[model samples]
Target: MSERRPTLRERQRSETRRVIQAHAVRLFTDRGYDAVTVADVAKAADVSAMTVFRHFPTKEDLVLIDQPARLIAERVAASPATHPLVRRVGGALVDAATALTGRDGDEPAANERFLLDCLRLMVSTPALRARHLDSQYALQQAIVDALGDDTADPDTAFRAQAATGACLAAMHTALTRWAEDNGQTELPELIARALAASFGDDVVATGRRD
Candidate 1:
């Protein structure tokens, strides 16, 4: 089957979202996250405040905009059915890191300062930090849905949660470490290394005892 392309409205919506995000980032960088309001972002982006809210449901979402839930879900949905759940999630995260870093392979994006700044803001702001935790739980639930019907079984659900937690915990560790390092290191590398360190030789193995 041929893949579906986005409609014109969808394209326009995406472009508008990008414009709003760019403006919001600049505003946040200049005046700090708490100081800038959604109205300020709307004015800078040359759109109405309602439009800004339509694009980003919350003020903190302007900076925490990357859709980790959707990204991981799509990759998990695309994986081969026979693949182990843990490996599928691990591979999904590697793919997500690559996409986030804007590289097909191991290379990183040229300009990650903006992302680092956004992460820093998320760290320092209580609202954004809380939203970050919410996002993580949402991502885990998305992963559970993508991992198929087996999650309905109690044992399978436990394994699913373990696998999801391990992968996401690795990702969070990598993000914090990268921000602390001032982004001197490539984010994709840090993410990959963190995943490897967490899973070691058995990315497919769930930590459940028999």
Candidate 2:
């Protein structure tokens, strides 16, 4: 027989995973992360607690699991080969933001609200906060590896880490400010302003080089 594709069992497993994640997010949002237990998620998902754990090793993983790590990696990889690493990464971020915002705009606003709620939970819950920071650090390291120069003595690793950290900090600051402002302003605009301020004229100059 030819190599077997995903069987019905596999499909069902995948669906179960999605359902568990959906229920977990709902419980986290409604009851708060700490208040919601694995049993609660299981009840909401109509699955057993073991199934939930099978999908996500920890409760915090459920919240952070769907983050777009692969998408970010792909965006960085798709940048112009001739561009400087920092410029390429920055351009990739802009592109990612545009892709995420959607054409009509309301979708992006909804997403921002959801993200804000998630961040707020992370901040209030110690375990979730630790997991969030750990996840972010891992992403930063991945970006740094993507930007590293093979021939440079000390390498561009430090710059990559700094740039990625700065970008993330800018976005977090913008989101927190927007949350405090009662969602009066558009998140994309705030993000753009933050990027401009952080990167200054380098953004324009970098774009021109391409």
Top candidate, metric lDDT = 1
Name the lDDT value of residue 131 in candidate 2.
Answer: 92
What lDDT is reached at residue 83 by model 2?
Answer: 66
Candidate 1 weakest ten by summed lDDT: 201-210
Backbone clashes for every candidate come to 0, 0
User: What are the lDDT figures for the candidates, one per model?
Assistant: 0.80, 0.68
For each of the candidates, the C-alpha root-mean-square deviation to the true structure, in angstroms, is 4.3, 4.2
lDDT of 2 by residue, 118-145 (tens): 6666767889878988987887666665
Misplaced by over 4 Å in model 1 are 103-111, 202-210
TM-score of each: 0.86, 0.78
Residue 138 lDDT in candidate 2 = 81
Estimate the overall C-alpha local distance difference test score of candidate 1: 0.80
